[model samples]
Target: MISSNMNVTFENLSDITDDLVIGDQVFTSRLMLGTGKYRNLGVAKQSIECSQTSIITVAIRRLQSSSNFQPNNLLNMLDWKSIWLLPNTAGCTTAEDAIKIATLGHEICKKMGQEYNSFVKLEVIPDSKYLLPDPIGTLKAAEYLISKNYTVLPYIYPDPMLAKQLEELGCATVMPLGSPIGSGQGLQNLENIQIIIENASVPVVVDAGIGTASDAVKAMEIGASAVLVNSAIAQAKFPQLMAKAINLGVHAGRYAYLAERMKKLSRAMPSSPSIGFPN
Candidate 1:
């Protein structure tokens, strides 16, 4: 059980004034960690604590069964009080399956406790090799989930049109992938992502294929509301160190965005004072 005094809605960071609003909830951290692919449970927990993210994602299927249940399981390992759990329907390949998994995710959150409230990260991928998100299945599931009033955040490709469609259907957030899942390619479809950001009324989170801290920095700098990184931290040689780096990168990028970075120049302009300096 979560502690009564634990802070779930906020984490103080003076540089950023705008909070990441998903549905009715607001989060201070722009970095959301995925609770998978870590070397060990201890490492995952340490990494998450280091990241200081308001929410961490867990797959719904893993939490439903008691077969592998133990003290080391994700639920027991997580500090449920302070961290918001955004469960994902990771393995579902069809709209129906995704819906079922999402329902289970909501039920699990309800039973466990809803400090931050129940939120579902909907993923429906049929392809195993590339593991790309199924846009059609995702849309179908998102429609159904929204009807049931679930705070649905659909994982999707960097398709601006699709993003607009999902927003129209009432999804809380639209997660556009930077690259293929776990590939570490880093913003392969930057132009499309930019379009999505430009058009989206809701939060646009850069999800998946973030290879390093720089990748995360680039995402937020390009106007993404937040980033969801898993493999970058979990697969790193030092998970905790990587996690801290990610947090820093996220803050730096968000600060840059909020501070309003300088406009792009068509030609080179001298920073030094040419009138005073030797030619």
Candidate 2:
């Protein structure tokens, strides 16, 4: 009973919808992978490929320090042409250090033939125990980076006010953590994250603390534009399989969101109409 026009429309749906735009870049995939904590460079490369992520975050400090000594380096392993680099300032504590690391990441991206890419995942995490990002330092770093024309995606706690402030400051995206970094605790601050998503003008990325495919699904279902997962994928028994599973979950969640889920009622309702049925 399907019409030709409806079939055509259904076929061309992908061409019209679900493009994630961050500043000057347009990405199809909502899942962003971090290139750290993998067992090896090969595993990381495979996971990246399996996840089908358009963007991959590289720790600039880690790459710089390990590239010289390590035979199999991350820079050489990844196919730079297809994958866009989102250089992250992970080890930096202060704004100054983060700025410096971000600058280095920019140069490294240029060297990798991504000359136009000025994307930086700004992280000014002064706290050592929880590995939480410092809001004040992140704000300072984001301001400076924005001034310098770098596309800043700052990782911060799930604070709605702070997310709005960053969006006002011309940040490309506000990446609020679901929980403590590498904790695999999932979305601990769901209410705050929802508030951030509701108020944010820019893309709200749920970064850090994702444990499994369900975590990614929860994040996406709750209206997060994207999710950046690292430890969960890297530390898994099968990184490639986990990556594939998580990618599918991300797609499922996104589609479910776009489909406009049915509203929840206070009381249960029967599927069959009561008046229509004859006893």
Give the 10-residue window scoring lowest on summed lDDT in candidate 1: 1-10
TM-score of 1: 0.90
lDDT of 1 by residue, 140-179 (tens): 9999989988899999989899999999999999999999
Off by over 4 Å in 1: 1-16, 274-279
Local error of candidate 1 at residue 276 (angstroms): 7.1
Task: Report lDDT (Cα) of residue 270, candidate 2.
Answer: 92
**What is the Cα root-mean-square deviation between model 2 and the actual structure?**
3.9
- Candidate 2 similarity to native, TM-score: 0.92
Cα shift from native, residue 104, model 1 (Å): 1.0
Error of 2 at 260 (Å): 1.5
Residue pairs that clash (backbone atoms under 3 angstroms), model 2? none
Stretches of model 2 off by over 4 angstroms after superposition: 1-8, 11-16, 65-71
